[model samples]
Target: MNEGIGTTGMAGNDHYRMTVDLNVLDHLGINLYSNIAAVLTEAVANAWDADAENVEIGIDPDGKFIEIKDDGIGMSIEDMNTKYLRVGYRRRDEDQETGRTTAKGRPVMGRKGLGKLSLFSIANTIEVHSAKNGESHGLRMTIDGIHKSVQDKEPFYSPEKLPREEIQVTNGTAILLKDIKRQRLGRGATALRKRLARRFSVVGEAHGFKILIDGHPISTADRGDLPMVQFLWSFGDEEPDLSSAGQLLEREALSDRLDAWDGDWSVTGWIGTARLPKQLDSDDAGNLNSIVVFARGRLFHENILDKLNDGRLYTKYLTGQIEADFLDADDEPDIATSDRQRVQEDDPRYVQLIAFLRKQLTQVEKRWTEWRRLHEVEKAKETSPALAEWLESLPEGFRKSAETLIAKLSALPVDQDEDRKLMYRHGILAFERMKLRGSAEELAAHVHDIDKLLAILADRDSLEASLYRDIVKSRLDAIKDFQGIADDNAKESVLQKYLFDHLWLLDPAWERATASEVMETRLTTDGVLTQDMTEKERLGRVDIAYRTMAGKHIIVELKRVKRKMKLLELQEQGQTYVDKLKKILLAQGDATPNIEVVFVLGEPIDEEGSNPERLKSSMAAISPGSRIVHYDSLIRGAQEAYSEFLKKSKQLDKLERIVDRI
Candidate 1:
């Protein structure tokens, strides 16, 4: 087959030689594109270069083939031999009369002329048919045949002639690709339309060009993100018709020109941010978090957004296009790489373009943040009237800080509106507290500091009622655990461990404190308190510990749950702790000290002669600020105190209901 096709001419008595190294096809063709969409872009670009008004693409997934037909100025026999088949053909260099544009006055997209070879990347067999000026011709090329020619060390390979009946088009060109590589067609027809729509800016009637995928003409709507655009900014004379952007378009900024190098270069096109970043994500079309760059209406770089290195929070939601035709000017050096997916980074034109885009991105980020804040504020106002009243009640300076805080919360990547509303509620609470305390300036300065903002919201006085409510809820849960342990008849040591860890159970006001470790160590040391205990007292003792909180030293004594003791015995132990702690403090140069002791026992004191009330009074007189609390009362008292706080905090109840509504 190799020898049979090696000598065949393209047409009757029309000998055409494809003079080139067969090895170059590997880099320029077979390895050029990895997907059907990328390969079809080259075909569409070729059609654009041919001044085709309408390019139709047909997908035949079942038939394992694709047909791209273009009603353009198709190549004649000699034009094919010299331009179509010739590798490294520089159309711009040869067509000096027409210059950089076609006869129809559209800038030509084909430069290196290697786009024709990209066809071989997807299909094993290719058939080309064209008609021009009352002449029709056809040729067929195969991967196997090209390989055979390469193996045979042939200088040139000729494509086999196609029968006249195979030339279906009478005024344009038709390319049929057979034996397609599997999974190259992408997700589906709709996905293909969107992908193609995003790649070219000239796929509309305004440019005298149109692309039809499976009989459906590609339109700007296929880009899929226009309706989701919340804010848009355009550069250059042409402002895109954003009416289709719908009600979501909150703002649009237009500029007449984007100049670089003293007007030696210029750019046009618009950058837009979606209402939500997820709006730009798709399983079919992939992430649209990119700023596509085009030159002469063809995609020059897939995404310069990454190259810009703008790591602002707003960049994730950005997707747009910039047309810098100067990147491909005939007067300047070609800056595009071989695949045209990127430009040479060091090129002066690209550097200046990056600079210009960075400036534009900065402006867009500023507007995007403000617009997002305004939008969130309106939504928040609509959700809760109380929140609206709260916002309006703030002074000018405080209101701005509150708005920024709410906006930052809204910008979180959380998906649910309820979660964002909850965050906004807490943010407002924190802001109000800060405002009351004259910390409005501090709130404004650290608006973006999430940790500091959280700290403010969690502060005890930020929303005192709400903070206490949360604390009450948590304490109730702990109380339940303590009751379960008592009901289970756990060991005395187990009960002691639970009580020591949760000192608040004994007294609602007591909390773990940052007491001096040295003082605590000295008080709990063996010689300090152990020397005072009798052998029988030591047998029943589980733990005796010291904690300082609320500016008072507290000593907690945990006794065996089964042990029974009198109020006189409890008063003696309490007095010992008080005297010992005072002496320790005096030895360290302190004269006076505040101290309290808590005795947690499983049973009440065994009073013999007098009633329980008389015993309690005598014990209180003996140990001043000390008390004997049974384990059951300890848990019950903690629960009742918190439950009572929850019941009485009417303001927090109202705030919680408002937040839930939001």
Candidate 2:
């Protein structure tokens, strides 16, 4: 059928006609590709097939269009109608005598002749201009027009020809895309450069192929990962240059062969692990925690790392590329999926590749663990010399276990170096405590045994004193936080919340435990505990509550920082709480319930018209264990109590120094 619909001063026979099946366009173009990068890769691959030396991509954010211009042997009007516009044109079969290579002796990257259709996946309209052999042609294709043709059941669709004045480039072809599907180019040109750079292997000066975005040429550095690679391993004949790996490289295994399936299959590429998993993550270039597979210099599989199912810890920091041209060899069956983003898992070649990768990962895991362990130990020692001395003091067997523990801590994906150092400091203290308990091996095996470490901290022996030192240091930090709040003149409830959870802040000896819910409920119901406050008390008042610790009941009343109450009023408040609690305990069949009332006030008591000693004595008479403490005195007393223990506990001197450094 003659599908020509426009006259461009050329002969009617030279008009462009596309005789593609409507179903093929829907299957391979409109619904096949998913993202801009994937669709753009197809165009770049086409440029490679055309033997393009320089391909420049210009993205116009304001114009809402993308222009890809290449310098290559462009097609004339005759070649456009017979080959360029033809569907399912197999270049390999048509040019078998030339071995599917371009005039420049480079293997072509196009085979199915369907890549042009992928343009429809991203752009609603496409414009093409090309010139060669003293003749040039331009044509435009719209998705809406194709859809209309499909609805009309037309046998062929003819694209509108561009006039001679619209032909801009004279030596190569330029394709302009408009009405893009995406709302915004995610991560912008920098990210696009990195992604495109990673997809092709022959995109540098040596290969004489260049792909530029905006004005900058994409090079190996645009891959955005080699500098972070601490360890690398290469397979097959070619070993990639590691000079870009910089001084971070600790070791490398180059030119290693994958001798599988009787050596019939051949692949080339290198895999590497970064020093930290965070190094593999990028705000612009996306995650590098993958092993992308490429065939015939084009991405075949986005990532085969997940398919290998290697559950080792090293995988998070792993990334690499494997070039297996045999997967796309002309003599072999097609193993690539329809979209060409991945390979068929059921294919025997892919199955074999997975098996080989798993075996290689095992070796990588072993080496990665050992190298990380040595590196972590050195870093820990540099951060804390006392920790280094502690490690050196250990016996040969214990020292080896400690090193392994350090390695495990380093690989924990903790983002901050200071946080990691804190973990190391605590880990050493737990290790020492475990050693005294003769369970050091358990600590080494289960480094995250928080409950076991807590049990050790609860013990009060000299051997476990180092853990106590760490606990005291943490409590001191909490006190410092509380001091900041009080200095800011925070609300009474804010201070109450802090003290209710951390009873040790009041008394270092009083650790928090499960309070009797029944007693609290009874106190609330009997009006002994109330949220309501009088107008005078609303300015500031003490909230009374009780908690049980170490077989003793302690009732704490937190007063506002601005409150000023007389000692008699404080005495009366303590007496009421004591009397009500005794009645409840007596009802619960305990006549001798040991209760202590601690009144924590922001301001000192109003000891008016009475001796301070006698007023205190009378208050003590009412509640035998009652005591009034100013906020400053309470904090000072707790600090002194812990500081006294730290000074006297000479055995924890080394641990104290390590904790200080952390």
On lDDT, the leading prediction is 2
Cα distance off (Å), candidate 1, residue 52: 0.9
Candidate 1 TM-score to native: 0.68
Tens-place lDDT digits, model 1, residues 67-176: 99999999899988998988888989997865478899989888877888988988989999999998999899998898889999998888999999878889888899
The per-model lDDT (C-alpha) reads: 0.77, 0.78
Each model's total of backbone clashes: 0, 0
* lDDT value, residue 137 of candidate 1: 95
For model 2, how does the per-residue alpha-carbon lDDT over 384-482 read when each residue is reduced to its tens digit? Answer: 777788788899988887887877787678988789888877787778777877767666655645676456445536653545555677777877887
Question: Which run of 10 residues does model 1 get worst, by summed lDDT?
Answer: 527-536
State in Å the error of residue 23, model 2: 5.1
Q: What TM-score would you give candidate 2 relative to the actual structure?
A: 0.68
Clashing pairs in 2: none
- lDDT for 570 (candidate 1): 73
Minimum summed lDDT over a 10-residue window in model 2 is located at 535-544
